[model samples]
Target chain A: MISSSRFLPRVSGLALFLFLVVPAPSLVPARAADPAEIRIGYLHLAESKQQPISLLDEPTDDDGIAGARMAVEDNNGTGRFTNQHFSIEDMRLKPSDDAAAAAKSLIDKGILLIVVDLPPGMVLTAADAGRASGATLFDAGSSDDSLREEDCRANVIHTAPTRSMLADALAQYLAWKRWQRWLLVTGSHPQDALYADALKRAAKRFGSTIVEERIFKDTGGARRTDTGIVQTQRQMPVFTQNAPAYDVLVAADESNVFAGYLPYRTWDARPVAGSAGLVPTSWDPAHDSWGAVQMQNRFIKLAHRRMKAIDMQAWTAVRMIGEGATRTQSADPAKIVAYIKSPSFEIAAFKGQKLTLRDWNLQLRQPILLSDGRTVVSVSPQEGYLHQTSELDTLGYDRPETKCKLN
Target chain B: MQAQLIRRGRIRRWPPLWLSLALTVGATSSAFAYTAYVTNERDNTVSVVDLDKMQTVKTIQVGQRPRGIVISPDGKFLYICAGDDDIVQIVDTKSQQVVGDLPSGPDPELLALNKTGDLLYLSNENDALVTIIDVKERKALAQIPVGVEPEGMGVSPDGKIVVNTSETTNMAHFIDTDKRDVVANVLVDARPRYAEWKSDGSEVWVSAEVGGTVSVIDPVKHVVTKKITFSVPGLRSEAIQPVGIRFTKDGKLAFVALGPANRVAVVNAQTHEVEKYLLVGQRVWQLAFTPDQKYLISTNGVSNDISVIDVADLKVIKSIQVGSFPWGVAISPE
Candidate 1:
């Protein structure tokens, strides 16, 4: 009897050990620390010799550097687990500084992700430099579609909404509003020709006819004199007189020298759009609905200023990384990249729909909010332009037509 | 002499019996009669604390972003609103697994279960609608339109009245549950958030986010009774904006979580007076109380910690680190 009792106690102890030692089915595997740290570098471009008429002359925080900083802050806040740290080594390229050398410097700093705010030629050089370093470049400022088209590199993600997308958004809205006849005003610069080309394509797609086309030359003049407004008031009307009998004035001034004066005192009391009035932007501060207020408030508190569209895009990119890291519980770059590309993954950017990246051009597909400097007029793909897959694909270049072939 | 002898005999026999009975009753009463279940939002779990033991006995995982938890009237289930999931997850009190989900509106932030346990009012912020769901049927019955960015919903003591606050619009819409219509819209202040009705349904207090004041509104009159403001040293007025407010069961004392001030303000309900500010974790958003009212748990969103306040002393006893961005707290009745 004593032997039997001792045996029974030993059997119970074995059972208890089994119960304690065996892992529960609900217990998750412990996450391993990631070895690599993903770093992103940023570059900014501002015009040399502060020309008052140039858009780049404004010493504003509304640029790629500010956007990169916001992205870095957000990434570090929630992206620490993923071992992804964004560092901005901003080199403002002068007319003299070698853009390629700057790109090489950023690459040498171990920054695999590069966001550049530069013109098309400089962007191409930087892209080539980035290719040499095996770094992925994201154009946050430039609207030139050619960079993503003819000069597309294997390691470039175009975060900047293309000129085609902007034109299409505007065209659809104008077509819907029954503004079929457009008076296209092209600027003198080559940049203006590119925008004009996009505008012409937009007109073709939306079945709108360009009634008249005029070239607005950059007349050499002082911008901010005490008597400049009065002089401009007199000069602009003559410059804009007897142009066309169209419904709207579509200005393509990439350099905002002349278009800033074409809004109210247009030739035929027509509404101005395309680069000035009723502009299509990725994000606007007036956008407070759909939980955007919280994001806006947080941004303002963190940055001590208003957030621009570029800043919002950068913020979204970093937020996407953070979301992926948190959800996957691993910061492995490959895993994070895979998660971001998955169709099931959708991120809430305080925008109405969950934003997803287009696999074709590597551009973020987002609804373009049309603003007139004050209020949001409308959001586009104007009603009936349906896509075979996602509605957002209609905003940018579709998959079948994309020239971006990632090597 | 005969009477005295009889009394002494009776006393000797009764003393032992009465003493034994008294000891039995005392021991039973001293045992824990209640337990507090605290829903930790970040942990995505619930902590069950035995009041007598003063320690957590069990922790059970629930759904994502679980907030606004309440025990069923029958005490058979615990209903938790998983905000991100957009459903009211029902947990069986015995098994503790999320057994089912109720058809709540999209992005349901706050919830209030009616006294009968038949209805649940959910503030669907995204849709700007208050969804009424039949608890037993687990289906949404009606979606009533409210003001912009509706959040922080509560049912009045009578259960007939429901109050929902629109954060951006700075107004509280009082809805008659039976009629399923808005009875009154009372304008409070800038970004009026988190409404709590008085126990008697005589008053409804709403926290103003940007205005840094709590507006006390008379429910019957649907007018502002008074506004209680807070001014603390070295703190900006805008930073002292109130977010969460809770009153004692007797409605004597109230606790208001001041955002960015890193403190909870204790106020005398009757006097509408700010008594003292108990320092807590940063950016305190919501709070819950133990059933015995011995402890108050406040969720500090930015700090990612739950500050436990000792009720008697009105001081922070402990700051327990939890999950990331802890937004809500619900302590089960002790």
Candidate 2:
């Protein structure tokens, strides 16, 4: 009985679709009486061998797409009474595939709302390709600050937090805890360098001092060898030895190099934060407060696993489209995009408050969660750190500092 | 047990002549206070607070995760929605003990009672159904399907209609009592958490926790007539989540519990304008009124305390510490 009631709406929708497809005039309704159909596209890169250091952090095959599917189901739940129906088309691109071509193919099929989980360069290519088609793309993967700044695209909406936002969230908690001195350890990768720059900016902005800086080269080694635990236990302490006095050791290893080995393996008795210990993220599996338990449970039930940060970003992006369509009561892509860009567009993804789009940068302004792999330590945009307009704006770049100028 | 219930109901209806005359003659205005029962969601207990004493007098344990609470019209029993247990436990007010349990559906979050208080209506959050149970018979008469994540239930003053608010669906479903089915669904703001009807039955107000607005709907037309937004000078708009709403006896003022804002907004019901905000404990979740309408109490979930508001003066007078995570409250008529 439970499963039947749950599927009844879709059954009726399918029946209606069949009725409308038939050539019989008596079964067809007037144009104004027909339900509005909304279709969304999800484009994500195929699975890669680059996984997190921890075995428990492996990404599921349906990670980002699963979240989009959940939002589509949620949208249909509301659409049943509103005379609307939502569907999603998912496309997985290989490493060598052209993102622009994949996006254009989806746009050609009348799916004007696209959610992209790709690298920064690929996101720009897909956005540019969809520009002529008037398709709106949601960025749900990349955290590169340049994507929201100098390299920003006019048609792209970013649900993923920038590196600056994550760094600032961690910095604010550290400042609140009165950990004013940081010993910064950066990886050799280019993405790691960008994250390190964001951390430096946050340290200066939040009145913290980086006492000393060190580098941890990747050196091309296997991440999970039999002797890994013993080697890291002895090597990490010596590598981090004799640094200038600091309250905390902040890591900038976005490439999953060495941050995970710094918690108990540090030479000094200090806490670790940044990309590993007490990391900042958009969502965590342990988050249960603020009515998030239901959302977590629903996602787990659908995906058969715990939700991840990327999943949450994809979910928010799809939910934004759903909110826009439901509010405007129109499936026209132009109208939906306009409504989403307006100041009235606010969506609640169990974040304790409604999240709105930053009109200037098109970034989703949200509170970042600080987690320690097991449970949520705290949420950012902490108390007493106020902005003139919004506390969420205090984390990322404000309007005055924006390098983005939408055409 | 039936005879005992009847005798207990009759004695409460009419006080002894000598006691009534003594109460009327001595401190008539000052001593008119009632007992407030609060359900602590985290502790799985209810704290019995005496209004006159301004403190918790006793604690009665119940089932797991008790949230929504309501008192009978005769003030003889209290119905507690134990969400985890999936049953509504009945507590005899006189003994302050669990007497029976009603067959509520899964994950009951909030509930409503009819005007005569014989029928109970509760929203099953997990099943998306409004299970209407016969209170005296302790059986579910009907389970009416509704939108997703139905959390709030409100009945009309005339007992003809009951409204259930679905959080995810963002709608207020009006269910006909006689027919036991949804008559109309009014789209409201996002994440609608609570529904309240005016005493005159003209408007039904639904509070949206995420959309941060209260939509006032015309019951006859089943359309939203007005959307009331809240704003505080220092707080951001998102933090001003309006949850539980209560109206005064005269229907002039309305008190809305602003969750996480740590305040209660007093709105002019006639003009639909916010008059003032009264600061209270942290994460105020629900509210209840004293029988005499002299004081209003708010449950602070985060602070684990109840703040008492002097209704006429519009001031927070006292805060009484209760069990952990005090979520729902109901006061006796006496």
Candidate 3:
């Protein structure tokens, strides 16, 4: 209790230690600031907004989400040098949700790259919002060419195959199969009219003639019920009873309101093609040749689901980002954008040629595959329709016909 | 009597235990001694082989689409190119674990390590560029533009020359390692894939997958010097497409894996003559040789078995079952 000398020394030592430990924070030079992270946004249509068609299943979240995830993973996987990492923030819009507001929220989150799946109007609105945010938009849903034509935006890139490209692919195959005369059935919608326009253009390019044109109204009714098939059977045959004497019935039913019933029971007993019977797509699960099996396996393992054309498009878009990052060794958006637009660059998506983006419209030039519901029937560019630049340009808008000006 | 009995029992037990210990040590040292790493494409696993016993002892899971594998020159690490994952996975040879991943180009299919083990040349097939990676830093230093679908790659004997073969373009691009740029694009036959430089570095041999022949190109002149074609009775010319080509240590004998022909053609390098055709399993894709050059292993992709050929006799020795669709093969230098 009376160890005063020892207690005094201990107190003196504690004071010395405190004096040494305090202050001098300036010597450390605040830990170097972390690198800026790159964020990408994804927008898709909610399940309720998709037309209630029963011929095929509606696209799930995995279709768009998995692709964006793959793109991010691939980008970061190869973006190590540039210290760039891609993050996806997805916003799914319901039937009544404001698409522009949803896009604005994504932009607020520092997401400057967007992959969108929406209808034409919603896509245009999102693009307008994206432009204000200085974000780059990749449209993976809409096939309307007007988005790339009259309404073309400098900030947007169209990843979805155009309606004209799909129609041309189908028309080329039909022409090859000697189904020269087409009974064109147009639906009562703007989207259907666009598809019909593409079909007519393809028919002219491939030496096929439209024998007659008919209109199918969007008569609203219960699409899904236990008795839907019986009702469709009773209504279809009578509706198409007086069709023109054509080789095939090319139905322009993008909304799938009535074309699914046109096959096998057509008025002329001819085959049905387009939107319902034989459609053109970028990818199909049944395709197993040309190293597709490997890609399919990788997709299944990564996403835990089967791949669709939309997923493939997303994957390609993401892969393109990775390619740019890896090649430039820089994550600066300007550098990456430059590398992507460079003519020397090409990316292999397991298709025959390395794909490159068009300078004017930013659309990827690719060979389209014509598929029946079950399997791939043929691939287009059809041997003879040659282009001075690339054969793939023959399917879509060529250089001479382009209305896109980047400025 | 008690002392003698105790001494004898101790003596009897001592020798036996010592003998058992010695035998155990000997067998253990011989069994799991050398590590042989195999890249599995679909399973995403690298199977380690026990060289002494000649069997796969352990399987280690790795990144997606691990295709090319090469043990470091110092034999301390294994660099595996995971194509789908788009990185070169570095595995520590000592601990048999993935230590780090090196940044390569997008979709690296094949890789060739420099002699000093400091630089790695990776073939990024998707982007059509050869990404030069600094192995120690695990960073891509430069990307040299090449032809389309650049898959097969190899380094010259002196390590001064790098050759990349593009399948679709049918051209073998010769690159100067010092400059890190393409020096020449020698026109080859259709589907020029898989190139192998001679030990002396005088010429480079490339396999033409669709041409069914191997073009011997003079690297100095940058032209094809001669073409070697294979013909067999009852076999279509298209089926005899050549893929992997390798030469013996002395450079006197060359073996080419003729895909779909189910055979490996042994050629006299000097004479440019086919010595013999060793029958193998179906769809032979690649080959590897034991260190002593006494045994040759050919991977039959479709059959999923490795055909073992006795080098001396140039005949099929045995076939060992492996994983489904075994592609590339390499032997442990140790």
Candidate 4:
């Protein structure tokens, strides 16, 4: 019982099938050539933190991955015309996982273009792991100035605004508003300390004077309690009391320690800015100009949450890759990276400008949005802040100040 | 620096009927009149500007968010896209009132009409669909899915092709009219908001609002043949966002409205070069040419006014306050 008839192909049957199918392939040679497939990896560290103000303000489960997916969809839509297809591999690593090892695993899986949503150290580790193979890593999470300075890597392209850029954006706007004197308040955390340094540098650059510097020491208290608001209201005003009069109060609380308690709770009527109140960010929920509403609406419908600054950073990184692929008509990671680094490469992230990568540091140049948690108050590099190359460059560390070797 | 151009031509106060008739024939043809219509986005009204008088004659209240507008081929009716109302209101220009509504999709941002005026191609910006409706039937015949956030509609001169530009997808989706199906898609720069085809239909120009470039594409090959870049001495490159493009009667000159830069880039159409940037109102959004091609009106959104430019000299002749946000403009052919 070998079932000999099943294995046996009749001469007439085989000839008829070949006759119809073989000519079809010959008739359309273009169809025989498959579309160029671009594979991207999104690497994020699995972590969570207590959102200070509202429970609803926390990052969603998808978070950075959702942005990558949207960018892939956007790229695929544009890619279909050029006979290119885009696919993303999302890999989230635990706190204990090694970023370098995880990056290697993704490389083994045939992903050379990676969007990293990791801490600065992990982003560096991931970049180091991929550099030997000419892999490109887009840093969407960290805003450390050192990543674009002493610790810069040729393989890493930064999409997130650096601490210097954010600080300068606020400083320029504050200068425009004639708030030239600042009462600088910084948290005790290392990240906050870095932000404080950037703010100081910005103040010096913009001719703004820091009247006094106060460090808000973190005492490790519960963020949300029945009596927490009462305690915070009493503590903040007293802490800000008896300070010399300043035009504005600028905070450097990147660690989410106490900046949120400064607005309206200050001892004086002066406004709070810089990491809180009127903060400078890559993207905000209230931004709706220059065709941003469409982006916001699409993101809301897809992710069921408002897109955050980190999400926009991740979105921008993936879009940079997508823009490169669509423009160059290539799926090769090296070609994409080269095109991105070239002066001709520009990507628009609904920022009312064509964002380009800086040749020296590979940092994307974009306008920073100053938001008051409700609406975009202003955008900087404000009117008078001019630059030799681009006004956007005026907000960040320009070419002359670069310590980056890009090796 | 001037508030407006002061070109006071001698007024022939109350010319005789015979002399005026002769002058009208000389200016236009037998008995034609030119009327420029501007859609006011925030006020939900269409301001009817009289070219003969150089002022707004009447303001017809349309509905919520009236942006894209176009006059019929015979110049009897005007189609206005009231975006929030989700209906394309048909207004009888003579009556100065909405006569009916075209069955448009979810959100119609822009509309394109064929040569015969038999079909209307509408771009549903929110839904990513292009609805083609029969003008006579007043019903949609085809709802073709296009790229994301379709905002610009361009119908080829031959009436064989319709090109729709999507903002988010950064593409021009080409639909073959006979089949009413998408035949090809061409990738353009980011946030393409408007598209215009040459008179001969050989090529199409698409304006990218965010990419800050205008891509001229070959209709046959569906590829960008030339990319036009603009530069004004003090204007930031990012602010030179191209939108609302228009070409002259002979196709020798093209006028591109540069958003936020507040200038209209006068381009040499044949060479694909920017000849000059004429300063206009803030956030210039759309452009319209009078039938005689002697003047061009640009809708300035941020300034809430329209700058009328003398086409021959590329100078701003007059700035007329229209409404809160003037987004789209159209003119009736004399």
| Local distance difference test scores for all models | 0.70, 0.87, 0.73, 0.84
Instruction: Write one digit per residue (lDDT tens) for candidate 3, span A64-167.
Output: 67877866755553333234566777777875778888888987877767788888888888888777667777888788888887778887777788998898
* Real contacts recovered, all predictions: 0.00, 0.37, 0.00, 0.37
What TM-score is obtained by chain A of candidate 3? 0.85
Ranking by TM-score: 2, 4, 3, 1
Model 2 chain A is weakest, by summed lDDT over 10 consecutive residues, at: A22-31
Cα deviation of B146 in candidate 3 (Å)? 21
CAPRI accuracy category, model 1? incorrect
| Stretches > 4 Å off in candidate 4 | A1-30, B1-33
Interface RMSD, all candidates in order, equals 23.3, 9.5, 23.2, 16.1
Tens digits of per-residue lDDT for model 2 on B9-90? Answer: 2311223456336545643465565889999999999999987667899999999999999999999999999988878999
Sorted by lDDT, highest first, which candidate order results? 2, 4, 3, 1
Residue range B67-111, candidate 4, lDDT tens digits: 899999888899999988888999998899999988786668899
Q: Which scores greater on DockQ, model 1 or model 2? A: 2
RMSD per prediction, one decimal? 25.4, 7.9, 18.0, 8.5
A1-407: candidate 1 lDDT, tens digit per residue: 00122112212354435434554222112347543455656676664343545343354644546656765665553333233444556677775577788888887776656677777788778888767656656677777887767666655666678888888899999999989899888899888889889989989988899998989887676677777777777876787788656888888987776777788777468898987888888888778754576567556756777777877766665555555554465545446656666664555555544466776556777678888877889887666877766666676567877787766
The TM-score, computed over Cα atoms with residue i paired to residue i, of candidate 1 is: 0.52
lDDT of candidate 3 over B1-334, digit per residue (tens): 1112122123111123453365357557633244456676667877776544556777777788777787777778888888777778888877878898887757788888877888888887655577777787665555666755677888998888899986544568888887776767776665566898888887789997766789988989988889998987666454587888889889899999998888899989987898788878778878777666766778777776667676766766456556666667666665
Clash tally for model 4: 0
In candidate 4, what fraction of native interface contacts survive?
A: 0.37
| Model 3 spans with C-alpha error above 4 angstroms | A1-36, A49-52, A80-83, B1-334
Model no. 3, DockQ: 0.03
Clashing pairs in 4: none
